[model samples]
Target: MREFDYDLFVIGGGSGGVRAARVAAGETGAKVGLAEESRYGGTCVIRGCVPKKLMVFASEFSGLSEDAGLYGWDVTGGAFDWGRFSTRLNGELDRLEGVYRKLLSASGVDTFDCRATLKDPHTVSLANGEEKTAKHILVATGGRPVRPDMNNADLGMVSDDIFHQETLPKSILIVGGGYIACEFACILHGLGVEVTLYYRGAQILRGFDEEARGLIAESMRERGIDLHIGTNIVEMDCAGSDDSDTGMGGPIQDTGETVGDSGMSHRGRQSGDTSDGPIRVKATNGSSRVFDRVLFATGRRPNTDGMGLEELGVKLGRGGQIEVDAYSQTAVPSIYAIGDVTDRVNLTPVAIREGMAFVETVFKGNPTPVDHALIPSAVFTQPELGTVGMNEEDAREQEEIDVYCTSFRPMQTAFIGKPDRVLMKLIVSKANRKVLGCHIVAPNAGEMIQLAGIAIKMGATKEDFDRTVAVHPTMSEEIVTMRNPVRSA
Candidate 1:
């Protein structure tokens, strides 16, 4: 008789969990079972990356007509039908969730479409009170968007709520300066909505290269994003409520509609609720305004709450992230965790790689450790920002470095008299000549950085980049042509 019902059972049917379960069951021939309380593809497919990128694409069209006009084409912009786009977007998400299910089924992995929590180190208890035993268990429960702790804070929408928004608001107050906040700020602005962003920090994109982030902030302000630094929400309430008074003068004029029940007021516009009016907000700067919606892009936390993890002796970080070793093994040898649950490199690709590493270690006996260094990331703001390796600020603090940087208006929009600028910068180590970082801020910067990431990952040096011939009339050619170090630190 088998000692356990399955060889491996995964909790959380996300990219990491699904990848690990499929590989272990199909390739390694291990009996596997997986469970997810929500959609199978988790945040990336359902909410975070895929849907938001589509929104970025939809939002980009709002500015194309003017650029096209400069190119001698009489293309005029048209109204954006959120209904049509959202319908298609939701359809796409449904298809993706189905694909995730099909992949697991084809791999011969058993999948339970319900929440599963740890009953013990090797035992999982499903929401239906069914118990499943496995020789090894992997937790990939992903992260979730969280609202700030404040009165009436529930009135604001989180990143997950964006996909379900049936209609776009006329004006939105996006709180936070992270990539999520900035991306949506640009996105909504492009979609013809008034976007006001408030971040209680000196600058947006705080940890990125200073020069790159500065340029992005400049471009965003130029593009009409009402961005305010060192600003945050002091109080918020549904427009016209008795407690919605802003000490600036008096309460914002009520539109004669009462606040809807629960969180429905935020999404009430979807149902064309006349009673659902804008949200009144008072800022730290002693300003008062009402926005059709208030989006809190502050942060995310790992989905480890009430999972019975701490009871099983699994170490959880301050952020509720499951603490695991190099091989993704927990304090209890039978339990393992990966993906956002581990909170190490929270990108989708990193989670998938961690899942693969977990399978290699626990199932194949190879004991592979997760390698997280030199990971490339992109902020999908207007013009986009793609970066790989250390930022200039961090690199200089660690060791001596040479920074080769260039900023210019690219030819594509330059001829049109558009002030759209792009930046290409490389940070090189003084001692080893290795390119420590590459940062690009321009159109399709995300795509350009992926190619550059390969060279940097292989330890390509500044001379190696210089020796490569420049492709003429190309902005990227500057990567190879720049010879002198603009600055060293």
Candidate 2:
């Protein structure tokens, strides 16, 4: 008899777990069992990238008519219908979850639809009071959005709650400056909501290239996002919760709208909105205002609580991320992890790559290590920010470098007298003329960066880029045509 019931048992049905389970079972002919407490597709498909990107697309339509009018087309725009868009978005998520299930079944992997915890190094206990033994256990429980720790903070919603909002608020106060906060600030503004963003920092998108993030911040303000730097909410309470005056103004009057079955009243007021009214917020700048909703896109933490990991001697980092080796193996052999749980690279593609590498090392015996260098990523803010490799500041600190950058109004929007501008920048090493980094800020920047990522990954030099012919009349062509370094650092 075999020592364990299965060769491999996976936890969390997110992208990383699903990919590893399917590949191991189908290709290596290993017995695999997988469990998921929530939806199969996890954050990206159900509540994150997929749904959020669709919302971004829906939000962009609020400006299409004006741009079309400039091009001599009489296109009329209508009020955004949140109900109609949300219905279709949920339908797409359902279809995707079904697809994830079908793939696992086709691979002959045993699937359990419940929460799982480690009973021991090689044992898994399911929520249904069942135990499964495997020769190996892979944890890819993923991460979750978290709210800040402050009084009455629970009243605010997180990124996950944004998807389930039955209707868009008339006005929202978003607290943070990360990609999630910035993206939604732009998204809600485009969808016709009054968006006020408060960040307790000098600038937004802190770790990104300074020039790129500066342009994004300027563009957000130009597009009507009331972005305030070095400011944050000092206090917040539901309107009329306290009778004391805020000094700037007295208590806000109730709208007298009856709460609906969805807990929201007339229009897009929140469940927190009572007969007394919406939420009242006091900012660090001592200004007070009322908002229909308050969203906290502060940050995310790995899902590792009560998983029986620490008991088995698995090391967890300060951020609660599982500490794993080059092959994604934990301190205890026979246990592994990947994806957001590891916190190496939080992107979906990075997790998938880590999973495949884990399989290659353990199942295939080829001992492959995860390759995380030169990964390209994008921030889906208005006039999206796409970047690959080091930024100018970091490159300059490490070695002498040349920075080539240009910003100009693109032809399409320029002809219409629109003020939209596109940026193309490259950071090159002075020693070998290697293109150390590339950053683009414009529409579809994410798509352009993927093709550029290939050349950077192959160690393409500045001369190599110069030798390549430019695609005329394209914003990306600036990358190849710029003959001189605008500045050196």
Candidate 3:
């Protein structure tokens, strides 16, 4: 048998890769080598979840100050200092990156700070001109936010760029109606930015429970986000230029090469002047506007380009996601993949679970299949949304379901004369009496759904939820108190 450099070679330093590498090395005592070209903590720790939640907490203060007065506490709202917050956020991220490095090192996994790509089925090539062979290779490259191929799209920023902004814009036009777009729109608005949101779809928060999303949309509007539905940007250019229609000029063509999956070009000039000018924008709705910034929270694609995977007979999807079986094994049995790169669940915790499953299957001589079902998720919109299992629309398509839902003004908000309302909903399977789904739209909904998720995951029945006595005067008590079915399908 030919001797390989290591027992395993893992690519990408994100959650999946690091977890797989460390577990295989520490627990299974596999000779693992992991390589990461950027920060080790990956998207969730470095850019996606942690920093975004901090911003969410910062944004909540504006409402907290108002609610304080209603509760007989004298609290005053103050201006948010993005500079100070961002500085501290960056420092915290740096500390986290260090922790990831330390964990990998202590696990006895050899770490490489350079990009690594597949040279062949068993061979790997690094950016620093190093070549190594492994018995098994894993790819967890993850994904990146993408902008649509519209005119002057480069002038817009993606979700990743939001963290690196030097300062907050006085006003911003946020495009797309997905969770990322809605979350940032709320965060920016809370931080005192004049936020405007545009979505080409009829409504925001698509793919969620209709009733829950409806309440979230109404709450977002009440919070003062200038939301426009069924709309999109057609053209954009720098303000103060008189070149063509809309008094701003034609679309600023992307002359530079595309970078990664983000759909951004390096050579396109910015859409505004250096002296604090707004970017001219023309929307499909025949509306023209000028804004300090245009943020495209449009969508994201898998990060698979230029990685040499396709050349190695690793099947890829239309979105560049790796084609994997239940074990995350690619067509090439020696190769496996997990996390966003596989496009399975696309959640950080799911990615970690997939990674651990991969290690158990490959290293421990035990075949483990990842379970992607009944995973709870939360969207950090102003009111927030927490959901688990099948939504109403999807459930009704396959089986008869009873929807038990309630929407009411909470006692706290009612005391303040606030128009805010919360929603709690349960979708129960009629045949099995099992709680097929649970959705909540309210403050701290994310925290609430976590406990609810445990019960639903265990196949808890509607009677099980009923037997659990309700906690009085709590918003979550509505979850258990909702007995009568509002509708059945």
Candidate 4:
């Protein structure tokens, strides 16, 4: 082997890449070099989740004036300067980038700003034509937004592009059926925009507990969002300027192709430029609508492009994700991948864990497997939805499971006299009574699930949750005090 400059070389300085670099170089005392084409903090920190949620908070306050009046506050119609909010998100992100830099530097890992492309199995070439070699090359370049293949998609935007939008769009048509799509629906709705969310399916979210999905849909409608659950966006027309008929002339798709034994392919997604009152949308049944701005919150594809791993014989799996074993090792012995690049579980924390594990197994010589079974996720809608472990439907479909679920109006709603409702459900194994899943839809449900996740992962049962003392004056108490229960539902 040639004498190399570093022990481990990483491409893409996102959550996983930076973490692995830090642990391997600092803790394991290995010489590590990290190459990043973008910001150090990666997608979740830079453009994906953090800044987007910040925008959500800003947008939500735009309509809060209406609710404040109910609490004996006086206010009139108000306007929000979205440019100002975008600036704030950017400033905060700039500070975050500095912190990531400091953290990586303190770990003694060298950083490269140019793009990295693997030449041979172990050699990497930079964009500026600098060649470097390492014993191991880790591909942690997370995912990127998939813009529609319509005319001037460049004019349209994806979830990542919306973080630092030039200005707030008065009306937005978001496309896709995923958590990001639903989360964006709630965020943009809260932000006081005429937001119309289009999901190709009968519902918005997929892979979530179905009951919670229904609750979210209802909550979004209650919060005044124009949600079209069984619809899609076929094409976006940006010929006019941002101000010219802000909602005019966008095409929709008619997915005439039926779902086969596997699923429907893009070949069946036919396009029709039918207009819907100046906004743009596409229905499965030959329909079209229009909007001011378009957001493809649909999903993300790994940033495995232009970073030459294919020629280097790196393996990739489903959805163009870099292939890795339990410890995140790639097909090539020295190459490994983590985070969205690996696409195992495309969450921020999961990538961080993979990064930590990669160091342990590769550098420390003591391997640790990534446990993804009980990973938790939160959709920060106006009323949040949080879940961990096997959901009721998933548990039932996968294995024989007992369902213990209850939902009721919180005390806040009783006093406020609002039509909002909070639902909580638990799925336990019929064979052993171990808590298989926990789902909640309420204010701060995400935060409540954080503590409950531990108990669920520890194999707690319905009886244990029932026996636990309730904390007064909190919505979380409902989790432990579920009065009604059915054996099987």
Candidate 5:
């Protein structure tokens, strides 16, 4: 057999790639090499999860100050300094990136600061014109935010660009109904930006529980976010251009230009000025407006372009996601993939888990298949939502379910005369009494669901939760105290 330069080659310095490389090299003493074209920490640490959560924490203070005033404290709200916060946030991310690099180096994994692509099944080519071969190759390039293919789409910024903005916009128009859009809408609104949200769908957060989403929508509106449902941006142009003069009154005409088979558009030439000016937007709901900035949190696509995977006969989905088996192995037995590139449960923690599983399966001689079910997730809106397992809508479709739900004003907000309400729902399987789902919509819902997730994951039933004693004077106590089912279907 031909000797390869390394035992395993990981292309991508993101969480999955880094984890797999470090573990395989450190634990199994494999000759591992990894490459990262961009920042080492990937999306979650660099721009996606960490920085976003910091902004969420900053956004909460505005409300906290108001509640403090109600508690007889002379509290006052101050102006938000985006520059200071952004600087601090960037410094923290840089520190984290250094930590990731240190971990890889300590594990004896050869790190390449350049891009890596496949030369063949066994050979990897780096951007620095170096080619090295490995016994096994792993792809974990991850994904990128996608903008809609409309007129002047490039004029709008994606989620990744939000971190790099020099200053927060005075007013912003956020498009899309997903968690990203809603979270930013709330975050920016809290930071004193005149925020407006437009979702083409009838409601935001389409896949979540209906009751939970309904309350979120109500809270967002109450918090002064101008939300428009069943609407989308048909055209966008820079202010003070010929295209910008298009009347604000009629519904936007459909371009009829279909998205190609690749599900992405060849980015069109940008029109109008690209300076610091308002952007003119015409919506499908027959309205026109100009905003300081437009953010397209529309969606994301797998980062599998121009990697030579297709030519190598690796099966790819329509979205450019790498097709892999339970073992994360591709058709080419020596090749494997994990994380968002595989498009399996696109969460940061899930990617890390998949990476660990990949290392165990390939190097440790323990065949491990990644578990993708019942993963806990949270959306950091004004009133956050945390969920695990199947939602009520999906659970009812699969089996007979009894939903035990409660929505009431929490003690903290009720005491302050704030109209904030919380929701706790448990979807129980009627036949087996197993808790099919646990969904919480409240402040600190994310923290609450982490513990609740453990029970539901262990096949906890309604009786199991009921038997547990309640924590007094707490919102979570309702999860254990609700005895009867609200409805069954």
Candidate 6:
């Protein structure tokens, strides 16, 4: 019933918006408002990070079941309840949503659990037609899945839709080659499902260090995942005879060449459904297989649609992410945006930093630009991939870089007798011997990279890494004792 609602208004209850609202409310003791159409915690908490990590753990643990004997544990034929796993995932997400809500409320920020449409730089209208006016506004609405229209009529779903899936697929064909695709590939393959990952590019994990990418690929194959690189989907329709209505997958090809025998040969032909019957899919390489489900983890774009940003004249770049400067300020001076919406280093922690920076510049009278360098990230593949700083390829492309790297099978594998190897790489500026990039692919690489990130942020050099003695019998020590530095002219 308050006529004038808040001093600060935040749209999109994702990471950036939430952080800004919380800090602004707590520090300034100002009445802050936040609005979210979806469940709180944004993509990272609800979909991207939390649920994905859980799925990865489920997948990895299934593999651990096989390696349990090596760790002195025995396992008979054990059953896994996909339903239980999915239920637990949902519970964790719910708990996280509750925690996010509590944080906002406890910090004295009022939240509107509805969509926020900007009426002006200062005014936002909610779904219930309730309007709030503020001195400043921030938008942090995150991205969503871009579903393919051609593959639409089939039973396949995108990365976002897979978490709440009703049934665990016996076999799944995941299309696309980005992190989301690769991450889910690790998850499904770890879950013991027959998984075939298709990437349109030559390599799966692009932008990471090449050696780490190779290592992850090798581990994936060792774990029995079928990776189809340089493959694509051309057309899809439902598999059914005498029924022209539904969609089916046709044939799958590799590099424009047919590979395997069509498994749907026995289904018989149907009118308007091609020679293959219903529930059929066709790959560009001309090989066809019937899968229980198809998944696409291609990539993500910014979520600047339908929230009335066009009317407000918000400019977007690089897949519709709002363009912002150092202080997270958009073109419109009074309006601000951060997090995935800004598309600058689309990580949760990065968003939080930008949010805090916004508050400092606006309310605290001190300005700091968002620094993305040395931001550590992890890809939870088996023998998990972690990185802070630049990899050799990116470093070379960006600057004159000297590279040092090593690959060794972990010692645990020496006892358990698995041949899968861990690969680590460092990119140092040849001009200054600065440790600009650190990359690793190994078990717990994500956790291991944290220390490396701190070192890199502290301006550690290759010599600094070498000056530190190597810790024996651990996979992480490769970072310190990189002997040969490969210089790129």
Give the whole-model CA lDDT for all candidates, comma-separated: 0.84, 0.85, 0.84, 0.73, 0.85, 0.74
Q: Put down candidate 6 lDDT per residue, 1-489, tens digits, no spaces.
A: 435567789887777778889999999887899988777888777767778888877776675666877788987546678899988888988998899899999998988887778887778989988988988888878666554545343346655667766767788888876667777887887776888987778887877777888778878888788998878776555554333554444333222110010000011111122112224567778887777677756555567766676577767775676888888888777788887767667777888888899999887779878887788888878878899987777778777877887887778876788888888888889888889988888888899888889999999888999999989868877788778875564
- Model 2, 196-224: lDDT tens per residue? 99888888888889999999999999899
Q: Which stretches of model 4 miss by more than 4 angstroms?
A: 75-77, 234-288, 487-489
Q: For model 4, what is the C-alpha lDDT against the true structure?
A: 0.73
Per residue, candidate 4 scores C-alpha lDDT tens digits across 379-404 of 77778888899877778877777776
Write down the worst ten-residue block by lDDT for model 3.
255-264
In candidate 1, how many clashes are counted? 0
- Higher-lDDT candidate of 3 and 4: 3
Clashing pairs in 5: none
Summed backbone clashes in each candidate are 0, 0, 0, 11, 0, 27
> CA lDDT of 43 in candidate 2?
75
lDDT per residue as tens, model 5, 85-145: 9999989999999999999999999988887788799999999999989999999888877
Which wins on lDDT, candidate 1 or candidate 2? 2
TM-score of predicted structure 6: 0.90
Please give the distance, in angstroms, between residue 201's alpha carbon in candidate 6 and its true position after superposition: 0.8
Identify the runs in model 5 with alpha carbons over 4 angstroms from their true place.
244-275
lDDT of 3 by residue, 126-232 (tens): 99999989999999888777666765666678777788888889999988888888899999999999999988888888888888888888998998999998787
